[model samples]
Target: MINRAEGAYLGAVRAFQNPMLDLLHKRHAPLVVSVLSACFTAERPNVSVADAHTQIGDALDQLRAAGYDESLPIGTSRDLCRQWADAGWLMRQVVDDVEVYRLSAHAVDALDVAGRAGGARARVSQSRVRTMLDAVERLAQDADPDALVRMARLDAEIRRLQQELDRIQRTGAVEEVDDEQLLEEAENLLHLARELPADFARVAESIKSMQRDVVTALRQDERPTGEVLREYLERAQHVMEATSEGRAFAGALRLIGDPQRLDGLSNQLDVVLRHRFTGRLAPQQRTELREIGHRIEQGLDLVFTTQREASYVITAQVRNHDPLRDRQVDDLLRDVMTGLQTWMPESRRGQSVDPLRRLPVAEVDHLRQTAGDLRPAQPPAPLEDRDDAVVDVTSDEARAWGGPHYAELDRHLVTLADGRSIVDVAVAFNAAPEALRRPVDLLGLLELADNQGMEETDELAFVDAVRPDGTRRRLAFGGVTTRMKEAVDE
Candidate 1:
């Protein structure tokens, strides 16, 4: 058998290894504790990532200004927060598309420890002793194996309460608890109330662990999907029974699940706060009593949110589970791990390798889902006999209907030029060949002029042109004149 000293030594080792004790043993424990307490409160237990970073940075600056610089961590708020998260002091999660930071169970425990140690009132008090005694008595009465013994205990309690009630009614005088005792009891209750957040966090963390385990089992494909799903379903349905913390919280939830129950608690707290004894209590303690119901509600909300998220994850995975794909992913991951192991022994120290940032896009081809005849169901109608339908067209008429002769127009413009001379677009159009003098040719001349850096005139110009079919038309547009270039500058 181990001696008491050895047992105590082993216990200390295990306790020190816990994240909560680790936080308290930190080099800058005071900074961590004070900053966390100032940042998080019962009213706002979690903060958005940006807001948390900003608040922490401000707090750090304040500390530095106070000449506690040497006691502070050596980094920006963001870096420090990330470090804390890695060390299990904070829980970083995404809520409603926003990343937020909440005190982890370990952090909450650490804060509780710091708060208890900061004051002399945390020492054993009369109310605390009485509370424990009453709890033990209740436990013993409830756990008695003999029905007669349980009934006798209940009878004794009822008689004692009845005797007090009769005396109060007979005398018409009610005895009140002393202010000092009331304050002590109130403080003891607050200590217990302060632990709710840590308890809620632990339950949420437990649910998450169960969810992760179920997902891993699903991906392994070692069991049938139905079997795995059934196991998860049972676990989800009886989540409270999955862990000791959850089971205890489940009982507390049942007691306070009713809205009226919480309202009653709040009313009682309000009555207590109004007493003269409350005036002696610190402002923080007064607020804690008043907001106790709200604090419990917030903790419950957090736990419910975690439960819903876990359920959603499991449902989505079950709906989309693919054994073949899971096996493929596992194979690929194994290959990657093997490659890394092979390369590690041969690699140089401090050497780095670039990561694959993206995978090749999947290429898919359109496929015809149905078959249909390429040819028409019926033969086409014979061409209409139109040999004598339109016999009035001539070559000149057809040429008039065609596009402008740009080549002929260019040749005419070059021939009319007198060595880099400025030619008015209207004049050039009038001098062009008859076949190229269609109204469309006027637009071509304008385009060519623009290409040669034409100069605009304030006065409008008109172009007179004859179509190949002897049709005359007049086009009016903005004046544009260009300097004709020699063939060498073409």
Candidate 2:
């Protein structure tokens, strides 16, 4: 018999090596691969047959224009889709009288691999080293039970860490990285993030497969209910506890659900994107990151929902086949009585009288008094005050209040010229009419930064201004610049 490890390996290989993949590798099947990629690139769960045909048509047109003279009619594209479905690379379903096609789990894996093979190179980061070290430590701890030995190893690790820190402090060294390198690292992080969702999709498929197996077993098996239930539980337990994928997925689920970790990751990415070494992300890149984040969250949700659905199915099946539920309480009680009678002697099977009935009434009263005396005393109740007091309900005298300070900042920013330091502009604004003589504080300047006309830059400036009270305040402000008129004209 093939062992479970061998079976799993073979199953994975079979999943990836579908006939459609083989066909796509053929010399004349380049267009087929392109069509599949175009259809699946949207990361959607499914596409309608008509939509797929249109996409394939576009792909074929592009291919034909590139010096390929193969005929690719809509009908041929449909036939190829059917072949893919037959090869288990796609699943076809009828929805609302229209046929739709979805990439199977295997197809998704294959496409992901193909895309990555042609994509940019991966970059290694500090997190990789930390993860590796953590994994190695965990393995060591699992392999060795001796606390002293572990402590010795930990001491050595601490010394090495201290030595590294000392070296850094002594050298006062800094590592400089180029913008291109940082951008590459950011791309790598995003690539890793995308893979997390794909892994979740695979796990969700596995869970669905497990659900189907359980249903089939429950429906087809003729064994005793307890025996069948035991088998099912064993299988479920093995999947959850013994499998590597299950453990890794469970860990990922926990990490994703942690609010602190998610916040940390978000902050880290924002810092990287906004850092002086990296610069701001393009609008399209930001959108892509948001989409990937959403997909990851959705994938995690899918895993949870799939598991819940599987649990519900198992529960329903178990209830339907439950032997305990089939036996009434009365029947169970009768059986117990029959067993008791079978074990007892015929003379000793008479109805027994209550022993307490034979006790004297005076003794019962004495016992009740003793039990009452033995009970613990209750604590005293809290005191309640009955005093009342009157209070004034009049509003305070109205005082002159300035409107939102930021509104003045916005008006001042719009009136200023572009490419001027923030301090020079602030000084000019203060000298202008309707400008606040109190001078805009840092908080007010930050509020200006949020205005459509103002943006923070690396430029800096200082200006001295006087308050309405004639006190001189030296202000340092100027990272903001403006191009409001240019934007509006555009």
**Per-prediction CA RMSD (Å):** 10.0, 28.4
Instruction: Evaluate model 2: give its TM-score.
Output: 0.49
Residue pairs of candidate 1 with colliding backbone atoms: none
Model 1 per-residue lDDT tens digits across residues 1-490: 9999999999999999999999999898998899889999888888999999999999999989999898888999999999999999998888998999999888999999899899645858899999999999888877779999988888998999999999999999989889889889988998989888888888888778778988899888799878987987787678788676677678668857787887778789988988999998889888888888887778788889988988888888888999899889889999999999999999996799988899988886986875697865678799898877775556766666777677777777877776657888887787776777788887777778777778988789887888666978888888878877763376
Error of 2 at 439 (Å): 87
The lDDT values for all models are 0.85, 0.63
Give me the runs in candidate 2 sitting further than 4 Å from their true place. 1-29, 41-43, 46-78, 91-101, 121-138, 156-191, 224-230, 276-292, 309-490
Predicted candidate 2 versus true structure: per-residue lDDT over 119-190, tens digit per residue: 654546555555568789899888999999999988999999998789889998856777766666566556
- Once superposed on the true structure, which residue ranges of model 1 sit more than 4 Å away at CA? 1-4, 237-244, 323-490
- Whole-structure CA lDDT of model 1: 0.85
- TM-score of each model, in listed order: 0.68, 0.49
- CA-RMSD of model 2: 28.4
